[model samples]
Target: MLCAVVLNAAQAASAQSVVVQPAVQVRSVTTNNVSFAEAEVARSDSVLIVTPRLDVLTVNPGYRLNASLAADAVTYLGRSQADRLLPRAQADLTAQLVERWLFVDGRLSADTTAGNPFGVLEDESSTIFNRTTVYRQRISPYVERELSPRERLQLRTDHSWFQNRNAGGTDTRIDTYLLSQRASYELRPQPLGLRAEYTRDSSDYSNLPDSSVLFETARLSAMYEAAPQLVLTLTAGSDHARYSGIDQRETLRGFGLRWEPSERTSVGALVEKRFFGTGWAVNLAHRAPFLVLNADMQRRSTTYAAQVAALPAGGDVAQLLDSLLSTRITNPVERATAVQQLIAQRGLPATLASALDLFSPSAQLLNSASLSAALLGVRHTITLRGFYDRTEDLIGVNPPPLFSSNARQYGASLGMTRRLQPDATADFSLTRSRVVGFGTNAGVVTNNLSVRFGASRQLSLRTTVSAALRRQWVDSTAVTNANQTALSFGLLHRF
Candidate 1:
């Protein structure tokens, strides 16, 4: 259905430009503690991983597509029964249906993740029994209209679905639908505006009927330009929510401010009163010649599926640095290479940052704060990131074991990189995290620590080689403590 929709929309567009990239990677891993065991057990293992991947990008006046797909084949030396194949993919499409008036956005993704937050964390090449594959898709179509020079309107509808493949009877399926309408009018010279918006969101579950939820909201906002670079907003709204066969209503009032003193800095904040209590959000970003920083904080009612879908495509550090480098680098290939080199030197993931997702089928009151900063010197690079979060299940106490009831998690990571030569780089990183659960799982706590050292060299224009040594330790009240050390060598080639 998604392919058909995109093809039909593309028929009305002009000529299209497309690019395809294919790559292969091989890695050899050796570990003394294959199962992250305690008691100084010497269970050694050797593993081999082969991966083939493809990326596609297409652009036209009326449509665009971006996709990445990969398959990883893992072999456990002398343990054929433990070998496995893993698949991963992410794709997104945007099409303009009626010039600039109608448009559609679609996304699809599949990956494997831990089903339980307290489960042991292991590398992708090493399989764990508590992992599950997740599939998600979403489509949204909207209409944008300029009623007049100072008036505008937008109407949109979204449909999303999420599914889990698990043998533990936690196989869940969810369908979500949303409808929204917004209109605004502004007095140009007066620098004042009034906007009204309405939204209705509904979710259905296949195995958890009682967890279904529906929300309806209507709001009116007034904005005033306090200064040339500052804006203030006041909003009043009402919310109606239905969950667990219960209906509830709440009054909403919010105040917001946006400050953009310069092109390199931006700050925005919002504070509101809602059903559970006060909800707040803050965002700050600043970019300098050799430094990039971003921070945000928010508290809201959300589901795990929604959060998963909103993850950044290229990771936190990579995305921010990419945006900052865009103005300095013009060629696409050069910019991408620069981004990769920066990530490799800093010991950062090219994808999303690591986190312990407290997966839940029902709604949760989530409060989270995160900060990331990077400094680039002539031959040295330093990166730091920190995050804190608290989650409370909205469905009530005594929930299923797979669902998170109440939990607090906090973590931080610091990395340093140095250029050994023109084509060689080395890096070191340390990460720490702690998780504590309340309510039914009261007194359960887990602490994790990781240290790694890595070095990489560019073998040729299309090939690169790298080696890394990592040590991981885990101390938990819910499970036995563990210590593991792994050494790996990898080669990647592109075509």
Candidate 2:
């Protein structure tokens, strides 16, 4: 269905450009702790992995698309775990249905997720049994109309589905629907504007029908332009919600400010009072000729699927590096490809600050903050990433005792890469993370520290060779402490 939508949208375009890229990699991995257990009980193993990927991109006046599919075939020489196949895919598409009046956005993604937050964490090549594949799809269509020179209206509807492929009696299929409307009118020649908005959101769980939720909100706001680059707003709203067989009515009052002094810098913040007490969000971003910085904080009631969808397909590190190189790379397609090449050449991680996201049927009040920055020099690149997350389960039906309440996780990483030659580079990184659970899981804590060094060289325009060495240490109060050392070598070819 989604492919049909893209094809239909492309047919309406006057001009279109398409590109497909295919690549493959062969890797040899050696690890001393195959099961990530205490050294006394650990076993060694040799693993071989083959990965193949394909990416497709299309762009035109009426539509745009970026998609990729990949799979990992893993084989173990030593019998610590069985062989497995891991598949991953992601797609993002936006199309103009009727020029400026109608538009549609669609997304699809699939990946493996941890079954238990406290379980051993390892890469896809590692034979980890406590993992499951998750898939999510979303589509949104919206209408926009210009009522006058200073007035506009927008109406939109969004539908999404979340499925857990190996769900064990839990809610395996979830559907979410949302409807929203907004209207704004600005007084001509004056710095005043008024806006009205309304939204309705519903979520249904196939296996747990009683756990569904409906939320409705109506809001009004008045905005004043304080300066050419600054705006201040005051808002009032009401919410009617039903969850966990309970109903709620709340008044919402908020204030917000936005400052965009230049195209390279922006800052925004909002504070509101809701049924869950004080709620707020803040964002800051700045781009320079040689650096990029971004930081954000948010608190809201959301599902794990929603959080996963909001993240960049390539992760935070890729997202930051893409921004850092935006000025140097103007074309979107070229920039995206360049970002991936840099990540491979510099040994940068695809992801840096992901939390232990376990499956849950109920909603959660999540408080999260993240900061990322990249510095680019003539022959060197430096990156920093940090994140903190605290989640409290809300409206949980028959929640597991160990994960029924609050969980807190925080981590940080720093990496540096230096160019050794025109086609070779060396890099080093250090990372530390910790997680703590509350309530029935109180006193349960885990800490991880990792150090890595790697080097990569381009053998040709379409081939590369790389090697890496890593050591990791784990300290846990709920499980036995352990340490592991791993080495990897790989060859990649693109065609």
Candidate 3:
């Protein structure tokens, strides 16, 4: 979700059960340069960061609740401007109000980050150039009712807001809301079904009101299962959008297929005719005991507000929920066996990694594709990923006609994790990316390499000492080359 995959064996080893818990971490970090710049502009600093985290889980017969909360207090030596206190929290709830009749699901989250790169908030690190503070919050709720044994109805609503203030005293804000309803019915005894959905979306911008938009869409779909492993679908829809008092409408038709010949392999594709042009989407995935691969491509029209709201934060919340659910097995041996059963039973691909790119605050037609693969072994792991994206009808500073331009981006990363001993582990990764803007903006290429060595040992029954070293590099158009080195030591106590 953060444009990168972080495989932590340590987390996997500790994810045995879900229970209410509180953890405290006190860390001290020393860095040679925190500005992510060359020696001429770099500044050295020492910071003490303390994080208090809490995990709450309540699982009952008819409802489940999961929540996480953390607060970071950062103190910088020599009175630097980068010192601040930050709080982040996320919560998810699912409840069955009436047995087999009514259901409710909801999610709420709030976080702060450094900047918005691809309409998503990018995490803060030593290599980040901009220090802008962006805060985001989102709330989504869904309700479902069983109309009959073979019929169902659902309603969903989402609200999100984002506010950011740059170092240069510039502030921006965006608000978005969406409401949708879906109905599904089984058409026959066989594997045939019909579904209809209607949605309305509205977005508002404090700085760019002209860029705000209101859109509505209605879709009808039919699906037939030809075999246990294959299914076919057809969809017809209409979309209407209004921007700055201008209305545009389009008719959409699409056909799709889903094929999974084996438990470890899957392929899906959809081709559609729309107002902008012909659009297509494809997905392919395969998984094995030691390897996993996923790839996808899509073309569509979207707004910046929608993209931002859809983007994930630092981690994959859905995957985290899955992991938490999987931890219900309290016995160690049973938990291990359950993991194997899950691996064998899983039929869907994992979430794809995020791509590094910039997003504009305007309605645009976009084409994007990505591929990610990973190999896991008893003691080592390897990962590779790449992506490409292009956009048209980009909004510009001048009014009237917007700029029609495209950007190309591609990147790959290789990483390996090894265990030195029972209590020590080390890993290293290298990533390279190139972004070229065709019509506007300067082209930039970036290379980043990082290595971390972590050692943890128990000091007592409930205390541990952990130390790590992280080194990173960055090359960008704004800054030719820069390097950062950091050493961190932490003490953790669990209760």
Q: Against the true structure, whose TM-score is highest?
A: 2
lDDT value, residue 364 of candidate 2: 67
lDDT of 1 by residue, 1-495 (tens): 456566755684457667777878888888877666675764778778888888777776777777879877878785733877877788888887776688888888887776556646554333343466677788888888777787777888777776765422245544443333333344332478777888776666556546666667777788888899888989899977776555889999999998999998999999988877898999998988788888889998766555655664223666667766866886554565577556644445543335555665566688988888877788888778888888877764434535554788887888788888867879787878888988755898888788888888877766778888988888988767887788989887778
lDDT of 2 by residue, 384-457 (tens): 87888898767633444222436798888888889999899898888888889876557878887888888889
Candidate 2 least-lDDT 10 residues: 180-189
Off by over 4 Å in 1: 1-5, 8-14, 40-42, 123-130, 146-149, 166-189, 313-315, 330-347, 352-354, 396-402
164 Cα displacement, candidate 2 (Å): 2.5
Per-model lDDT: 0.72, 0.74, 0.57
Top-lDDT structure, candidate number? 2
The weakest ten consecutive residues by lDDT in model 1 span 180-189
| lDDT string, candidate 3, 312-360, tens digits | 4212323422333342545533443344323212211122234432444
Residue pairs in candidate 3 whose N, alpha carbon or C atoms collide under 3 angstroms = none
Model 3 scores worst on lDDT over the 10 consecutive residues at 1-10
Q: Estimated TM-score per prediction?
A: 0.89, 0.90, 0.77
Name the candidate, 2 or 3, with the larger TM-score value. Answer: 2
Who is ahead in lDDT, 2 or 3? 2
